[model samples]
Target: KLPPDDRLAVLLGVIFCIPGSRRAAMDDSEEDDRGPDESPKRPLKGQACRHTASKSSNDDEREDGANDGQERPSGSEGSPSKKKSRDNIPEPLSSLHGLVPESPPRFVSLEQIMTTANGVTNMMLAHEIAMDDTFKLTKQEHPEKSLEHTVKKILHQAFWQVLEDQLAENPPNYDQAMQLLQEAKETLLGLLLPHNTSLRAEIMEGLDVALVRQQAEHGTLDFGYYARLLISLMARMCAPVRDASVRDLLKIEGVVPLFRGIMDQLEVMKLDMVNFTIQEARPLIQSHSVAYAREKFRAYLETQALLSPGLDPLVHTRAWLRRSHEELRALSAQYSPDPVLNGRGASGPPFAVVLAKAYIQLLCWDPSWEYPETLSMDRERFTLLGAQVEECALVASVLLVTHSVGGASLQDISDFKEDLRSHTRLLLQGCGKCSEEELTEKLKCAASQAIKEVQESLQKHGFAPLQLSQERMLYDQVVSMASAEHHIRKLLTMRILDFIKLTLSSASVGPTKIPAGLSTLEKELTQIAGTFLRLVTHNRAVFGEVYTDIMAQLRAT
Candidate 1:
């Protein structure tokens, strides 16, 4: 199988050029008709030629199964250069048959570029969802034309009308009906497994094309009998969810409409079969995905080596773990002498801890520092999680101080707590992403809102508002929370970080074991912790060796 880059190239080639089997035959005929001195045609402007690789039947499937239900860009692991590998690349005529033939390279038209782009996008989406237990293929509904579903309605109507007119003749033509019967039989057979011997025999005997043809010749053609039988077979073969659709087919009357309904139901059943196969294959794919991904990544790196030249593809990786590496080192210094075999990282961080450190970095990741290339599959997810972590931290810490300063006056007021949460969320929108100056300004507003909620709650509960001196003290404490050095904010941050550390330390850990001062955010923090831990655990299993090697190099330096 080709690497991801070449696989994309093959997709581009297939849509733009003739299929290999037909193109080869055409070349042979053209050579026979040409004179001895004749030269082959050259590519014109906006066209180019190159040697194309063949795509294997299972290559795309394997590529999807190789990842942990995510489409990681090929360069994320081995991207050593800024220039893309596909830059100014020539058009390729892919070989989809067996081996790539040594036939002369052919020029390709640029007409199907969008089609190839769409195909690649679909392949990525398939990879991202293949492991989902609830994954199912649903029939796509085409939208109406001119503000109505005229296009689909028109096509179905015209096709059925053709069959009706053909069957209305004196001799009663069965050609279209015969073709429909053949297509239906194949579709039914496709829905069955190899072990379905009895059902297979029944289908073949019941819908025999020869039997229908003979019936037509004798003018005893029973269209109603065939239609009823097809519907009965479909009701038995289809899923329970499709029982309603099968019943709708049964409700239909007349030869034309029934057959039209039968054809549409057959298409739906085919999709169901495909979904069933994916569900059956998911466990096997997931079981072997780790090893498969390792190999796929290895091959990708080899390809990137030629494209990237002398630059190290893992530059960001080393930088990502550099800070954690120093902390772990200094912590080790306070204990004892290090273990031998440093390169294997015997005294270094456990793979789980390494990933935990990486995840923590994600929560506070500097936008200026590039994300680790190895973890690129979850970049967007991390960015979102970072925003949530920052917002939750800010809200929880502010609310804590608010409750303490407001005392029992705000204790029983659930509405007061909710108001604080809403105001905090609004003010902290895009908290970690926007400029620090802007975030500080927003945080100041958040502080004021917290103090206001507490005061409003006290007055509503028939308690006096904070005295002037008390109000000034509470305001100063809350506003100072905007700074990173704020004591109350730092305490809350420490508690949240500790809670995360506990969850990442063990696979069996649960969200129930929340640290003190973070109960207000237990649910949100637990979800973030769980998601981060799961991704890091899987990623560590895939790239633990790489992490070990990088750490050993850092220690040596």
Candidate 2:
């Protein structure tokens, strides 16, 4: 509207006075603050054009700035006459800030992205349709293509792309990548559902690889995530077509092998983390989907059973009388070594003692209550006396081992015994309620029968003749092991008393049915009774009073 010079001066002043001018000024100040030894800052003289361009030539100045690849300067510089002359020029014009140079447009076009994404999607869809058709043909008659192979290929492609993309980007666009992966997974799952009979094994294999990658990347395995993913995938694949043949194909055996393979790989790759992961996953593995858990547990049990003998070596021996003396010396060394005796050493750990007791219990159970097929032993009649004996031995072993380690107390043993007795009584009462008279009569008859069987078995097994000698020797060992402490003697007395009470109670109730490959309760009890009797005989001077008291109690009963 005004004269050309005035209009140009106004335009120049506006361009130079923009917010970008402050930014450019601050940048210049920062550069000056860095000191002169760093990169020398060339003063931006071309920026003066922002305050000097003619109104008609403002667009031309912006084009020049873009072409020259130089930033526009802020503020006036030099004498007032020079500033006035520069201010008369028109300001530069730009789509962005007028003070900064514009960058040249890059060559990559958005059309390329849209076209690539569309082409890939279309190709994936076509492949899925082709796979479905092939699966249908294979089911009908032509077996040229397998559904498992097709699904495997699709999953391999999808997972490989995801892994590649993740590795290429430094902090990848993870949300978008995850979405794409999820879509790929869903599509593959859809294809697999209709052809589940043929695809389950391959699908499980693919899942195994994915899980392995996840574990390897994270260092710790997450059972819940893997479990839920598997469950969802299985549900999807099995929901659409419910065929018996297809269901059989989806059976746990086929799927479990793949998961087992994954676990094996994890063990091999990250052995240190495996134990921690297993411990954490224990509850998850046991509670969620119990059928699958049971199968896995059975497999683990079978493996453990195969390895048990090599790990514990004491299970295969019998001839107690012949080996009893030799084992005593070894037991002494194991319990209180020469170094420990000389050095005032503490006892072994409580857990070690627990482990030892568990071993002894296994021996007492084997070939006594539940005869193994390998042993070819005849089954004995049920006797509450035998059950009592097994229970007493287990309790005594736990007490002796725990007490020997200097960890557990006599009070703990007594408390545990009371709990056990209460539980046993509750179990018996739950089995059926009878009148007091009927229960007493049954108890008397069972006790008499048990005594007769014990006498016959002792005679047959030659235990009666060997009992005195074994008891004497074991008693001496117990005294030496206990250092003649009143507490030890008291603990031993409690063990005997508890055994007798449990025996009488068991006799009153009748023998409990044990699992196969375990000894009858009566036989185990007789063995423990003999063992205890030996202890008393060998330590008569120290334990004689308690032994007499126990004998009187047995007689009275």
Candidate 3:
């Protein structure tokens, strides 16, 4: 018997050999051709191969060898030449000659196998052409045209058909599908890295289709796939080898075609019955790998500011605002009083709000060289946009406050006043709704409970407690004051002045009210003035005098 290492080497040579073992013999001859001074190819030496093969064979042979009446060896070492010749013999010829080899199967290096597999994958993806008799005359008349025509004909029939077949199969055989996808991705990535412009475009078109189909078939999308595709495409578009090409491709005029193509595809996908939300889609769209794409696109727009005259930033800003408005309208239409509302169409408006905010912030903080002309315009537009957002926030808060205050007693209202005051102060600070016109308008539309909340908060903060009749009369007066085009300014001034005066006077006479009944009257009068001051300061125009008068009255008292 041959030694195990010799047997393995012989098996490798035989397995790799061409038909008739010509290549194997040629290999041996090539070895021999080396001069005597050259060292001989050393055989791999070790008991590792033998022990492994023997143990595996022994396990399988115990059952099969018994049926064949073959004797199993007891782990004895075999002769080296015997083992070599036995393993080197081709399987078909060995079977014919009734020879059995005591050697392990041949194994190839993993890298070699992977390289071959990748090659096969490429072939499957290659574009092809076909021959037809009808094209013979045409080819003879126009050889160049014929060549191009033939190439396209072959690609459509052969390459396209294979892709169609793969796409048609539902839940594609994962291994085969992944192999093709991987090969295509590798090809595109390779072309992109080298900045091959024309080739990269072709690859990108194919990759886009593959990605869409993959998402559709899988019924889900992953952010990573989109990230890789965007990064590769952006790199090719920006590479130094194609600096001029990159600039041209990224130009506002030049990018329109690509942008339109992508937008068209997005619209088509939107019509799909799948319930994919923007929240689910955003991470993929805004991923770091594609961040450069956004930057480049924005830069292109900025460049247009120099070229195009009177380009309004509001055009894009308005588009975003309209989109958010439409989303909110849709949400209201699909409203449902169920927890599941969080899933379907309900989450869209919030996402739209977030997207609008992000886009606005980007334009507002833009540091690109071309942004100076447009930055002021964008900031003004966003400020106006913020007012709309504030209105929505206030409306929502009002609803919550109304719900919370329902059917509560006076004591409950008193206890809740602090909480109400805190929320009201927060809303006032954040919403920028302190203007007389805005404040009056808000009060006119406010729920009765919300008005009561304001009143209770005012009284609890040491503002005077009006009689119920007097409070109702004041509420009507404020509502009328809010409605009038002319009266709102004066009403706001007087109300705020009264509030500040009341607060200061009460503070000046602290604990004096508890000891003397007459001081209680003084405290009530002070509280009234404080409440009036609070209202007037809501309008900046009247704030100065109302503030001065309140301080003057407190000092006099």
Candidate 1 residue spans exceeding 4 A from truth: 1-180, 193-195, 213-222, 252-260, 273-285, 302-355, 364-373, 380-384, 412-462, 465-498, 505-516, 553-557
**lDDT tens string, model 2, 1-557?**
44433332232222222222222222221211121223432322222222334433655654554444432344525558867987996654554565666443333222333223333322222222222222110111223378855764565456545545664575433333333334334333333424466566655565564565566456564533553454455444432333332333334443233333332222222222222333443343323322332232334334344434245221232222113323443566687678644232333233223222322332234334433211111112112223443344333332243233322232244544344333333323311123445434433433333233333444554444324444344334333322223454335434544454343234344544332222223354555454433322222322234333433332232
Worst 10 residues of 2 by lDDT: 373-382
How far off is residue 510 in model 3, in Å?
Answer: 31
Ranking by lDDT: 1, 3, 2
RMSD of 2: 33.7
| Residue 249 displacement in candidate 1 (angstroms) | 2.2
TM per model? 0.57, 0.17, 0.22
**Residue range 376-495, candidate 1, lDDT tens digits:** 766877787777776677778777877888887677777887777778777777775666677778777877777677777788889988877777777777666667767877677767
| Candidate 1: residue 460 Cα off by (Å) | 6.8
- Candidate 2 deviant stretches above 4 angstroms: 1-484, 487-557
TM-score result, candidate 2: 0.17
Q: Which ten residues in a row have the lowest lDDT in candidate 3?
A: 127-136
Judging by TM-score, tell me the better candidate of 1 and 2: 1
